[model samples]
Structures are given as C-alpha cells and as structure tokens.
Target: MYTRILVPVDHSDTSAAALAEAIRLANEQHAIVRLVHVIDLAQFAWSANEFLDVPQLQSSLRESGEKLLTERVQQVQEGGISVESELLEIWGGQIARTLVDDAVKWKAHLLVMGTHGYGGLTHMLLGSVAEGVMRHTHIPVLLVKATESK
Candidate 1:
C-alpha cells in the first residue's frame, strides 16, 4: 500500500542497511523511492562564521550531499526501482525537524531510515534522530538498525 517511500540516507553503514530495505520494499510494491540527505553545517552551530565563508561552505556541503545521493540513487535504479533525491541544507542542528518537514513537503507515505540503536547514556547524549522524527510526526517510520537479530 505504500507507494511513496522516503529514504533518508547519510552514507553510514546503518543508512546503507535502511536503503537496502527500502529498495526491497519498493521492488515488492512497485513504489517510488525518494532519497534525501540533509547537510548539517557544524560551523554554524557555534560562533565561528568569521573563518568560514557561509556561502562557500554551504556550496561545498551541498556538493558532497549531492554526490552521496547520486551514488545511492544509481544503486537503487540499478536494483530495478524508481528513485529521486534532494539535498537539504539546514544551518542549525535541527536536522530531525528538517527531515520531518521534507517528508511532509514531498508527500511521502513512509519514512525509512537508520537508527544507531543507541541506548542508556549514549542515547541520552546523542538523542536519536529517528526518535525525534517519530515524536514529531505521525508518519509511519521504518527504522533499520546497523545489524539485524536472529
């Protein structure tokens, strides 16, 4: 029933796992996959714009994101799935919020992403993005961890 699958990949191993799952689902359902990569500019997180040209840094980040998306899109296409991609730039560290917003804007039926599977202290400190998305949006989310259990 899910025809619009949104896959947010960060080029990590866990993200790769998520992409694989999304592709498999897409193949089964004859769905379209939208690949998204959000560029979080760390330099803007603190007071440090003097050394970094904002536009230049943004451009560099966008280019890197595009490259990442291009490779993943190719892989999905080769797997016999239709795909489209976009690179989102958010200056602050609210990446999870941006992702949720993008999902709505794209009219995505589902969000398939990777979770680091952090727990306890690490989870408290890092604060999971997948978790954030889940809390903020009612959209059905399929979180694929780095590894699977038997």
Candidate 2:
C-alpha cells in the first residue's frame, strides 16, 4: 500500500541494511524510492574559527552527501525500482526535523532509516535521530537497528 518510500542513507552498513529492506518493500509494493542524504552544516559551523574554512568544509560536506545519494540512487535503480534522490543541507537546525519536513513535503508513505541502537552513555552523548524523528512526526518510520559489531 506504500507507494512512496523515503530512505535516509549515510553509506554505513546500517544504512545499507535499511536500503536493502526498503528495496525489498518497494519491489513487493511496486513503489518508488527516494533516497535522502542530510548534510548538517551547523554541527561544524561552531568550529568556524579564524583557522577554519567554514565555506570549504560546507562544500566538502555537500559533495560527499551528493556522492552518497548518487551511489544509493544507483543501488535502488539496480534493484529495478524507480528511484530519485535529494541532498538536504541544514544550517543550525535539527536533522530529524529536516527529514520529517522533507518526508511530509514529498508526501512519502513510509520513512526507512538505520539506527545505531546506542544505549546509556553513547545514547546520551550522541542523541538518536531516529528517536527524535519518531517523537516529532506521525509518519510511519521503519528503523533498522544496526547489527552488533563482530
């Protein structure tokens, strides 16, 4: 029933797993997939001192994000799914909010992404974006938890 699937990709194994799951779902539902790579420039903006070239850093982030999106789009296309992609840049904004806004704007039927599944200290230190998205939006989110490292 889900016709438009939105997947956030970061080129990590966890994200690849999520993409695989999204591809399988898309194949079964004959749905289209949209891959999104978010570049949070604000996170690095704080380090923009006299020694830091903020503009160059931002450009590099955009280039890497675009590359990731292109690679993911190709993977989805290889799965014989109709795929499109977007590289979203957010400055001094929440990544979860940016993702939810894009999904809502695209009218996506589902949102699939990977979660690192950190707990305790790690979770406290690096807040979970998936958790944030879940709390902020009504969209159906399929979070593929990362596999345990060997």
**TM-score per candidate:** 0.90, 0.95
Question: Per-model C-alpha lDDT, please?
Answer: 0.90, 0.91
Model 1 compared with the native: what TM-score? 0.90
RMSD list, candidates in order: 2.4, 1.2
Worst lDDT 10-window in candidate 2: 42-51
Q: Give a tens-digit lDDT track for model 1, residues 26-79.
A: 998899999999987765546678776877877788888999999999999999
lDDT (tens digit, per residue) of candidate 2 on 1-150: 999999989978889989999999999999999999898887777874678888888899999998888888988999999999999988888989989999999999999999988899999999999999999889899999777778
Residue 66, model 2, lDDT: 88
As a whole number from 0 to 100, the lDDT of residue 129 in candidate 2 is: 90
TM-score of 2: 0.95
Error of 2 at 9 (Å): 0.8
